[model samples]
Target: MTLFVALAVLAAVVSFVCSIVVWKLGLRFKLYPQIRERDVHTRPTPRLGGIAIFIGILAAFGAAWLVSSLGPDRFSLLTIVFENPAQVLSILGAALMIVLLGVADDLWDLDWMTKLAGQFIAAGLVAWQGVSIVSLPIGGISVGSSWMSAVVTVFAIVLVMNAVNFIDGLDGLVAGVTLIANGVFFIYTYLLVQQTSPFNYFNLASLIAVVLVGALAGFLPINWHPAKMFMGDAGALLVGLLMATSAIAVTGQINPAAAGIEDLFAAFIPIILPFAVLVIPLLDFGLAVLRRLRAGKSPFSADRKHLHHRLLDMGHSHLHAVLIFYAWTAVVAVGCLLTYVLPVYLGTSARWALLFIGVGFVVCAVITLAPLGRRKRLTVAAEEAPAAELPGVDELAGVPETHGPVTAEAAPVESPEPPNGAR
Candidate 1:
């Protein structure tokens, strides 16, 4: 745990410095593209933040290698990397590939098919190096064949990457949501390791999650509301790829029977938690695809009708919409985590966790729909209120009406432009 924390801190420091440097360089070089019609932000911003995130992750891995070489113990924090050097290298190589693909798309606006092909290639590369899902925790079901496992893994990675990228419509939405999701997942993976491998808790999944959490933490200061730069396609897809990798690394490695997880819900948590954390992104992705298909457009075509866009259209302030995403992500991810936590640590039933999830869902739903109620009330009030008499031309020409001078409170406040340009 101490070593993990150290690596995370290192990643965060490096990422923070890199983000500032990147933002400055981007601005100096005029690297950003013109604001598109579908964008939510008003100003043009750079989209090369992914390069910093990838560099930060690389630095952490390099530090891990250094520690493994010089530290007293051989298998201290590099257990996974030492034992499976090929796999670790493959994951990094795949990540680099993804970053390049994203950068190209960010700069050149690569076609959907070309980007899709690149995603599959990167996913396939990682799967080939043993990151593929070999089994499920439910009833200890294993993949029938290696080919099947690779196929499933590739598909899952692509799905998650696109799902995550699809929701990068709002500033800080992806970074903050991914940070919260990975933070919970890091805890879950850490606890699971304590139970499954008590003596050696250093594993690939937790390492990836922690590193990602740190990277996002460092990048988020600049990526927040009124962002200085966007993560672009590269950063979003890289997040999805790594997050999917972390989930796959741990989720399939555990066997319910071997791990002594007899409770049905507990057994399924390995499968459930990943999707639970990603519920919003997946939901948005699914809806977007369906919407485009129904409209006779490409599934990967860009649009302004995403869930975040609706929140803006529904009158949610920029910050409020981003926070709503953060809130729901925390509620769902933590709630699912609790189901596993209560049973393992407290020996309590999962009913408590289920209740928490139910209540959270209701609260989030109401908050999400609150704008509708406010709009309805305003509509009713407008209908019931008597119309005011129009002032004469003289009054409009700065002459005082018989009603007297207009008070500051009575003056109409001009609404500012909606913060909706970042993508």
Candidate 2:
């Protein structure tokens, strides 16, 4: 308990400080990006936010190690870092690979293939550390084939890394969603730690989950709407990789005796909950790929047809669109979290809680997306005058047009996806 609280605070503070430091560095180095056609923001903002996040993770882990080694007795909670060095090294190594790749992309705008090579290499490193899936649990059957499991595990990691990169379109979208998903995963994994048999090893998954939540929480304020900094591909991929690793750890490492046959739902929860936590982004990834491929374009192509883009086209402000996406993400992840979380400790009564929360989420969605009729902006003079006093359409036509956004289109229908994940 003491270790977890201390770790969370340390990680959050380090990440927050890193964001500020990186913001300063970005300005000095001119690492931010200018406004582009497919971009949502109107102003240039820093793009090296991921640098701080990566540094924060390292600082937090170092602090944890120092604390566990120096603290007299009560701080043994983090001793797992010292005891199981392999797990800690594996995750950090993989994370470093993605962070460096992000930095390269931010600086030089690496081609998609180059960045992808980095992703596969990173995923492979983690798999080499015995972090890959070894089996699939469904009903009473245990599907085990070493080669197939390894392939599946690495592919799952890479798929999520790309999915998260795709959904990093709006300000604070990926950060907020990552926070919610990691928070739920943290709670679920912590509960599993409590329920495991006496001989179960340390819960590295829970630690990774909490560290991710802390890092993302610190990043969110700076990355919020009307943002000062964008996380670019670096932060997006790092968080996504963290999420995938945490899921793999919990699902792959559970002992068979602990997940016995009696509880069918319990047995299935390990396999289902990880993916359920990321349902929205995964769904969007699939849809986006299909939409692009059908248009005779590469699956990596970009368009303004993303869900948030549609919301903006409907006249919702930038902040509103981001909030709507946040609400929808919370609805799915939190709802799934509750279903499993409530049932474990509360038994059948968990179903009622699930029903209530599920309905509440639906209500929130309906209200968020309620019919908001288009409202015309009224000038002060127009608001004060009657219909007879209003100017005619010809009077509006007489107003001279200034140099502004172009409505003219030519060549390709959709904007090509930016190489740096800037769009």
Say which candidate scores most in lDDT. Answer: 1
Model 2 has an lDDT value of 0.73
**Per-residue lDDT for 1-423 in model 2, tens only?**
456656777778888888988888888888875666787666667878787788777877787777778763755555754676776788899999999999888777788779888998998888887777766554224345766767778898999898888788788888888888888778877777777633332477887888888888888888886667888889999988988988887784344455433334455556677677677678888998899999998776667677667666655666776777677667766766665566566665445545765786787666555534322333444566799776544333333333334465533234323222235
Top model by TM-score, which number? 1
- Give the per-residue Cα lDDT of candidate 2 at 94: 93
For each candidate, what TM-score against the reference? 0.92, 0.82
Error of 1 at 36 (Å): 0.8
lDDT of 1 by residue, 385-406 (tens): 6767444434433345445566
The lDDT for every candidate, in the order shown, is 0.87, 0.73
Worst 10 residues of 2 by lDDT: 412-421
Those runs of model 1 whose alpha carbons end farther than 4 Å from true positions after fitting are: 71-77, 257-262, 389-415
